[model samples]
Every structure is written in structure tokens, then in C-alpha cells.
Target chain A: MQVPAPFDYKRASTLAEAIALLRECGPDSRVIAGGHSLLPMMKLRLARPEVLIDINHLSELDYIKVDGNTLKIGAMVRHVTLQKSHLAAEYYPIFAEAEEQIADPLVRNRGTVGGSLCQADPAEDLSAVFSALKADILIAGSYGTRKLPISEFHTGPYTTALNPDEILTEIDVPLRSNTGSAYEKVERRVGDWAIAAVGTMVRVDDGLISEAGIGLTAVRADHFRAKEAEDSLLGRSPSTEAIAEAASLAARHCNPFADQRGPEDYKRHLVEELAKRALSRALNRSLPEVH
Target chain B: MRVNMSVNGVEVSDEIEPRLLLVHFLRENLRLTGTHWGCDTSNCGTCTVLMDGMPVKSCTVLAAMASGSQITTVEGLGANGELDPVQQGFIEMHGLQCGFCTSGMMLSARWLLDHNPNPSEKEIREAISGQICRCTGYENIVRSIKWAAAHSQNSGVQQGVEA
Candidate 1:
């Protein structure tokens, strides 16, 4: 039977209490929000935290709203909530697209944004979606709060910039007018992780590409962001040639390892194709008449 | 650790290890074995239960984390010893071949019908996409959920749901 090692579980009523508990419990302690990712890791003996501080009761952190031009999502917001939030869909449909492909509905009901980000799995879809949206993450630690760009949040696979005494509190996506975003993933099954997926955001100004962001996942894309492909799309007309060229750049740059999903060449091909489709959809959505 | 939670409308308390999963707690501690335990890794939905009225894989949830929460297992689907429409649908439509995945499938169907009284075949399929059924190939399972939707709409929603 898969079971976690013995540990003490503490439910914190307040964020301060949670942080204090984390500091007191030491590095062997973990702050668990949804626990979907952590618990499974624990069961496999891959993660052996001696203390778990449950933050599910910190309802104060479970919110998604627009604070001015920024779309702010609380870290504790459940995946199902994120998938259903019209506010998030209004700004970027990528949230729904990515959330739909995260896992089964049952798993999504218990998974949280903070937990997903902190887990930092390379095949995780939200990281690519948020990377494409150019979002910022707010992390609260014993010292104070720190706002880090999503691009810099993941230091490596299964790792983040969060400290042991810190908890990610919120994710902020900058709302841009004349911009549209989409996420495209091709998983082996309905709920499996992506073999290679691409998320794209494009701002069309006067029939020209004003801003472009491309995020790739499950293909060893560094920081899950394709800066070269994004840069290639800027200031250019959203044309077939331009998009294909950018897609080729994204495919060429990513380093995908072979696995049961497919060979490296096939994954790279998916990266190029998915990137093209996502960019086209994003460009189409950016046009008011097209939408 | 001592945990208190409502299981099937009854307040229950149990002394459990913090690492004890909710599935194990329900099966061993509470002896509600109707909720099947499969794929201890959380990949299989056989360990699903209603946590605060939403379907969650209990295998991945710690019993200690369920303190003060309301959990409804497969045994709670019926009322007054009457079979739920979901269960009836399964019987009438032959939704199960082996019945190993029946309880979790029924609970997910119940939750789906609760939220959407008349879900399309596509919607029903999407709702239970997380669950694995080695038998039935899901064709009859989809029809079974549709049957539940029809039955509920005809007889009206029984057992007022909170949610």
C-alpha cells in the first residue's frame, strides 16, 4: 500500500500561524494547500516531510478578482474554480484551456494553484499557461511579501524560488487590451501529462503583432518560456510565414527527451505544430471582429 | 492525532496517524468498505468520495486534513435504504461488468447529476474522465449516467443536496 511516512499534521487558522508553524517545524515541514501533489509524492516516499502545515482553512487566500488592470488569483484557488472563473476567462481563456487538461475533474477539485506552482513539475500545464500570460507570483515569507515574475519562479524541475518559511499567496496576470491567449496540449490520454504542449499570447495592434509570448512545457523549454520565439513574433505582421518561422524557432530551441510518450523528434514536431495552432488562435481572438 | 468529521450526516471521531489516508480511514477505521480502495497512487478514482459535496480522490487526502469537513462515501448515496438513481441506472443499464469501479463511478455520476440535471453524453463523459474503468469500455457507463439524469428529472431530485 502506498502510504506516507509518519508526520504531524497541523491546520493553521491564519496565515501568520501557518508561517510561524513552518518556521518552527523547520525544513522538514511542508505547507500543504490542496495536497493532491504533495500527498501522492509522500505516498511514494519521494517526499518525506516530517511536518505538514495544512493551509486549506486559510480561506482568505482563496479568491480571484481584478485589482485594477491586473487579474489577481489567490494561491489557494482550486483548479476547478480557476477553470470556471469567468473573470479569469475574460482576461485569458488559456486558464480554462489549461485547467481543463490538468487532470480529471476529481483531482482538479482538490488541486490548488499555489500547490501546483510550488510543486513545479516540468510537465505541469499551468506553468506553461502562466508563463505565456506573463503573470507574476506573490509569495509571503517570514520576512514579508515578495513579487517575482513567473518566468523566474522556477529555478529547476520540481523546484521553485519559494523558501521553506514562505508560502505563495497570489498570482497576478497583467490584463492587456487587444491581446488574446490560448493553450494547446496533446496528452496521451484525457488526464495524462502533456507530451509536448505550447501556450501563446499575442497582442495585435493595427494588424501588426505588438506583443507576443510563447510558453512551452514537457519539452525541456527553459523556464517554460520560449523567449526567442516570442521575440521573433514582435513587430511583425501575424502572418502564416511569421508564425511558422516562430514555431520552428520554438521547436529547434526546446530539448525534449524521449520517453514512452514519443521520440525527441516527434515531441519537437508537436511543439512546432501546437505553437502554430496556439498562436493562430490567440491572434484570431485578439481581433474583435474575428472573436 | 484525533480527527472529527461528518461522514454521511453523522459526526464521527477517530484517532488516526497523521499519515493515514482518508481512504484507509474510511475503510479500516470507519469500516465503510463500499468506497473501494484502488490505485493507492491516486490514479484510479475507485477511492473517490464527496468532500464538502464535491468529488475528491480520498487516497491522496490525509484523514488529518479532513478535520471538521463533511465526507460522503458511496454508502451515503441512497436515502432510507432506497437506491439512488445513479445506482438504479447502473442496474438497469448494466453499467458494471466487474463492479470494482462501480462505487466511484456512481458517486461521480451522482455529483454530476446533482450539478447538472441533464448533462449531455459529452458532459457525462467529461465528468468521469478522471476515473478508470477496465470493464464496460465506458459506453454503457455513459448511457447509465444519462439514464440517471432521465430518472432524476422524471422523479424530481430526491434527498435535498447541500452544496
Candidate 2:
């Protein structure tokens, strides 16, 4: 019989109306998109906002499209939509793969991208996926819109750089040619949070690694990324030895705490193994096939 | 606040508190107990209902958010006193032992059949992955969904039970 503490609820029919309500409600107010993450927190008394601005009616913020070299995704886009989007699969298969592993279908139907990123749970899969993709997020406020790289969005666990009055409206992912990405997670069960997950993106140029991004989640990796691993793979051929060394670097850089999931050493070991597998798969996908 | 929505093709309105969850609203206010409430968290699918023709965990959704939206519960599955193919399949294939997870499972199966008429066993399992049946009756549940897919067109006609 869990119920949220008493609070005033207001539904905003438009984005402008929502921003107006946010400005009026002040910092004690919070915007709820899907209510999957926020409501559960409210039930536990972890989050007790005085006012909840429901933004589900702002359907204008729900879309997935490719413009120029960027794949722009609306904040209101649900997890199920991303998992089923052919455009997302073609450009970055990591999104679809990670979406499939984020909760189950019932939760996916209502869980929005904005809500997930805003929640900023350390174990959330999309944060790692977007971090690996080096995406940018658009935050809309009363004044105007501002864009911030996903790496700079999160300041701490369950915290984002978003101001109380600002609403995240869109996620922008840059599309790269001859690049491949993959997400690997080790969850205790189907819908459980990851013990340690790794998302890797690799771009090969002329048989050398031009760029690489390795993002880790649930392991307390700084900035939710493995910069040491990324630097180790740059300007080098993604050979077996290079990949193994880079995976070890990712494992060495993480700081996982022991909990019900497993001990710290075990999670760090998973970070190493999963990072290696993701890097290997990404490299395989990036390289052209030889007949 | 006043929330108005369509439940099972019927328009309904209620003056519910903003904190009222859609699950409690359905059971307490509207007396639609067919939508079971289990595991207040979104882990269990027993509280699942169709919101705009897609299955969503009702426990996590506020009734206020459902305003002007269409919701379909197990009570709305069959029409004219006839069972939906999913309902009949459950009965014939013994998809339930305790029957606590029946409504959610049947509704999810119905959604899957509507979208994909010929889903394999793996697909059926994946479709209902969110649902939890403590009775461990998943084998028959899979078979029940298959039965509905096999007899989707003429669910009214009873077919001979296979030996």
C-alpha cells in the first residue's frame, strides 16, 4: 500500500504551458513524463516534490529523425519506440540492444527517454549508451534552449546539470560513418539492473582506430565513461592485444561498490570481460568484410 | 481533480486525488477489479492494462495521466458474453492453476496476437516477460497463446481437443 505524499498535480497541454507552469511553481516543483521513475521514488518518500507538472500531454516532444549528421530523439519518446525504431537500429544498434535490456515491455511502454536521463540512476542503461555515443541533450527553459554534451549532463548519482526550471527536450546523437557500437550488460535477471554494463563505440579509419568511446554503468566509473580505455584504443589497430589492454584499462579505472549484486572484484572483472566483448563486437562490425 | 477517460469503450469520469494511482482508481473508484494489483513496484505485470492499445503497468501510472486516454482491462476483452480467443485458450489449455496471473497474461497474449498473428514460442515468452506467475504455469500459458493464434478467426467454434 505505497502511496505518494500529498502534492498538487497539474497537466500541461503544451510545451510552452509546461514551462510556464514550471516557472510559476518554483524549484520545489518537478516535471513528470512517464511517472515510472518519479512515482516510485515518491512512494518511497525518496522524492517529495510539492508540485508535479505532468508533461505527458506534450506530444510535440516525441519524435525520432535523422537531420544532417545528427540523429535527434525527442525526450518524450518511450523506450518501446526506441527499441522498435528502424532508424535507430540502422544508425546505432546499441540503442535498440540496450532498450531491450532496460526493464520489461510493460514498463517500456510508459518509460520515456527524458524520464530515464533525468532520473540519473547510476545503473540506468540508456545513460551509458548515450555516454558511449557521445550524444548531446537539449534543455529548454523559460529563456531559451541550451545544449550540453551527455558527458557533462550528470554531476553526480541521481543528479543532472538540469536546472529546476529547465526541461530536457531532446537528445542529439552524431552519426558517424564506418563506426559500430554495441552494449553488453550482465543483469541478475531479465528486468534487474545491471551489475556492471559496458557500451563501446569504435570507428576504424584506414585499418587504424580513429575514435573510441567506452561507457560503464553501475560500477561508479567517473563521468559514466572510461576515458583511459578510450585513449588506449585511439590511433591503434583494434587487434586482439590492443583490445585486451584497453579492456584492462577500463577495469582498472572503475570503482564498483559491493552490494547484493556481487563483490567489488567480481563486478570489476565483469567490467573487463564485458568491455572486451563489446569492443570486439564493435570492431568486427566496423571492419569491412572480406570475401 | 476531475479525470475523464474511456475504459472498455465506456466514458467515465471521477473526482480523484492527484496522488491516486490508476490501479487504485480502477479498483476502488470504478469497481474494475479485473485489473489486479501486485508488487506496487513496476516489476510485476499483474497490474497491466492497455493504454492506447499498448500494455502498461497501471500501478506506476497516475489516474490523472490517463485523462482522455483509452484503457482496456480484462473486463473489456470479450464482447456479447463471448470469450475472446485468449480467454478460451486459457480455459482449454489449462493456462492457470491459481489464476492470479490469468487476467494480465491473457490481456498481454491478446495484444501479442493482435499485433503478430503467428508468434513463435520464444516470441510469446518475450511478449509476456514482464508478467510473473508464481504458480510456475508458463508452459501451458505458452500453449494457450498458441491455441488462440491457431483459432483466432473462429474462436466461437469449439475444436476437438488433441490427443
Candidate 3:
């Protein structure tokens, strides 16, 4: 067994303290919320920080609140909570469906949404879902706080745009519009990491496509929008041919890697199939009259 | 750090490293070895234990974070040197050949029954998907969970198995 390197451990009772510690420790201290991703990386020697500042004890950061126009989820909210939340099921049911398909119940119970995003494993399922949902990440720093769109937050594989002195505090997702969203994934086996996953959110107005956002995961270095596919569907009533064409375009945009799961070309093919299926489902549910 | 939590109905307060996983705290510090550690990667639920009545992989949970929480290991279920109904059901159903994954299977089953009393086969399969038992091929373990869920409560001390 590979043990983690020796590190200083600190507990923060408040978000202010956590941010302050991040500023003070700079590059050495890592904020640990659930440790579902970071701890495993630490054990594998992929990450070896000088300090582990635990934010799990900060009870103030564990809540799921539905404000007037947005649903705000604290950074420490576990994936299981999001999966089982009635609010998520009512407002953002697609996220619930995606959460249900994550690693498994044990990882879901301990993994936090913010940590998953911050870890920025490009192939992360929830990251793509949130990116397609137009979620905002609330980050706290020594200066104050700032929010960034999920699209702009994740920079690359295992990297985020967050400054070393910044810590993510909450994830704010907008309430659904006259829209329907769907998440579809292709994995090597049940309960295994996804080879490629697609999350499509479509907003329809009077049998016409008003807006569309498509996010792809595991097929690229980072979760990215399939703007070409979205562009193809805009202002048109989606048909089988159009959806298939858009999916093919999405396939062309992916940068999949040949891994133990599948070949890069196969992963690209999966993205196309998954994107087509997900977009069609979203279109059907969002614009039933047109379908 | 000084940590305080209840394990197996006993309140424990001890000093521990913040990076120490709850499984190590329970097994090494508290000397509760019933909770096995199969894969520390959190892939296998062998280190599963009930934290605040919810089943979680102890290897992923920090001992410091578990402070002030209520934990129940596999040892907490039995009574008077006997096996719990779930444990006995595994024995009766031949759920184990090597017995390495028994504790995780039992705790997972216990948590499943607590949330869902009469689970469908799909739900049962989903509940224990986190646990991996290479010994029994999981057929008998599923059957054992079903049997324990069906017969244990309604039987009311019918001389089948005592816990």
C-alpha cells in the first residue's frame, strides 16, 4: 500500500478561516472537503501536498437551498444528498439522474460536488452536467468572494481556474426554464468510470428550439460545450436527421484518449451515439408538441 | 487532534492524526477488527460502517471528521456472543466461503433494510453494488440478504437464529 506523505492537518470552523488558511499556506495547503478524489490521488502519490486543511467540519457549508430563482448547493453537500434531494428531483431531475449513475453509493455518500469540480478530472460526470446546466461556482479568497461560470472555471484535466489562494464555497444552479435535460454515458461496465458521457439541456418555445447547451465528458481534456451541435439545433424543430447530423458534428469535436476502457475512435463514436440519444430525449421531453 | 465519537454504543475520545482514516482508528486505535479493509480506494465497501445510522466507506472518512458522529461497526450488531440475523442468514444461506467480505455485506444489507424494508431484486442489487465479495460470487449473499429481510423480523424469536 502506498501511504500518503506526511503533511500538516488543520481544521477550519468557518469558510473565512478556510480561505485565510489557503492564502497563508499558498501552494502547500490543500483544502479537503470530502477527500473522495483528493485522498485517493494522495494515496496513489499523484498529489502530495504539505498540508491538508479539512473543511468537512465546517457545518455552515452543508446545505441545499432553493431561493426564488436559483438552487444553491453548498460545497460540502454530498453527491448522495443531491441524488436523493427532492428539490433536485423536482427542479433539476437530470442532475439527480446523473448523480444516480456516478461511481456508486459509497462514493456518492462521501464525495462532495465542489471537490469533484475542483479536482477537475475532465471525465467527471457531474462536472459535465453542471456545465450544461449553466451553474455558477462560488469561490472564496482572502480578498472576498467571486463567482465564475462553470464553463470558465475548469481549465483542463486535473486543473481548474481557481487561484491557489481561492477555495470553492458553493455551486449555484439556475432554475430550469421551459426545458428538459438528459445525461447519457457509455462505460466499460456497470459502476465503472465512463468512457464518454453527454449532458444535453434543451429549452423549447412553442415547438421551436429556443436554446440548447451540450456538454461532453471523458471524450475531451475537459468538459466542453458542443457548440456546433447546439448551433445546428438552434431555431429549428429538431428532426431525426438533424439530431444525427449534430451528433456526428459533436463526434468530430471530441479529443478522446486511448485508455484501458476503449480506443480513442471508439470513445468518439460513443460520444456521437450518446449525444444523439441524449439530445433527442431532451428535445422530446422539452418540446413534446414538435416531437 | 482530540476526537470524540460513539462506536458500537460506546463513546470514545482519543487523540489521532487528522489524516488517519476512520477504518484505521476503529481497527488500530479502538481495536475493532471486525470491519475489514479490502481496498482503501473506496471501490470495495469492505470497510463499510454505519456513521450516524448511514452506511459509509470508513476508509474514505477521516477519523477527525467523524468526531461527534455515531458509528456502528459490524461488532455492534450481535448480542451475547451470538450472530445477528443478517450474519446468521449468511451462514444459513452459505453466503461466505472465505468470509472476508461478510462484515461489509452485513452492514450494507442492514443499511438497505433500514431504508427499504422490502426491496426489489434490482434495488437489492443496487444497494450492495458498492461491496465486492470474490469468494461467493454474490448469488448467495443476495439470497441471504433477502432471507434475512423476509424472515428475521416477522418470525419473532422463532428459534431460527439468535443475536
Best DockQ goes to which candidate? Answer: 2
Estimate, for each residue in B24-123, the C-alpha lDDT of model 3 and write its tens digit.
Answer: 9999999999999878888888999999888888888888778989999999987899777788889889989988888988998888877776667788
Ranking by TM-score, best first?
1, 2, 3
lDDT of 3 by residue, A1-291 (tens): 535667788888898888888888879889998788888899888999998888887888889998888989998999999899997767656788788888888778878988988998877888888877878999988888899998899888889988888888889988766788889987765568898899888888776788888888888834477878778888887688878988998889878889899898899889899988898888777754656
Docking class of 1: high
**Candidate 1, backbone clash total:** 0
Candidate 1 Cα errors over 4 Å, as ranges: B153-163
Clashing residue pairs found in predicted model 3: none
TM-score of 2: 0.97
Across all candidates, the chain A TM-score values are 0.99, 0.98, 0.94
**DockQ of candidate 1 (2 decimals):** 0.82
Kindly list the per-residue Cα lDDT of model 2 for residues A94-155, writing each as its tens digit: 99889999999888889999999999999999999999999999999999999999999999
Which pairs clash in the backbone of model 1?
Answer: none
For lDDT, candidate 1 versus 3, the one ahead is 1
Stretches of model 2 off by over 4 angstroms after superposition: B154-163
**Candidate 3 local Cα displacement, residue A197, angstroms:** 0.6
Query: Candidate 3, which segments miss by more than 4 Å at Cα?
Result: A221-223, A288-291, B80-82, B154-163
Docking class of 3: medium
Candidate 2, B12-78: lDDT as tens digits = 9989889999999999999999999999989888998999999988999999999899999999998
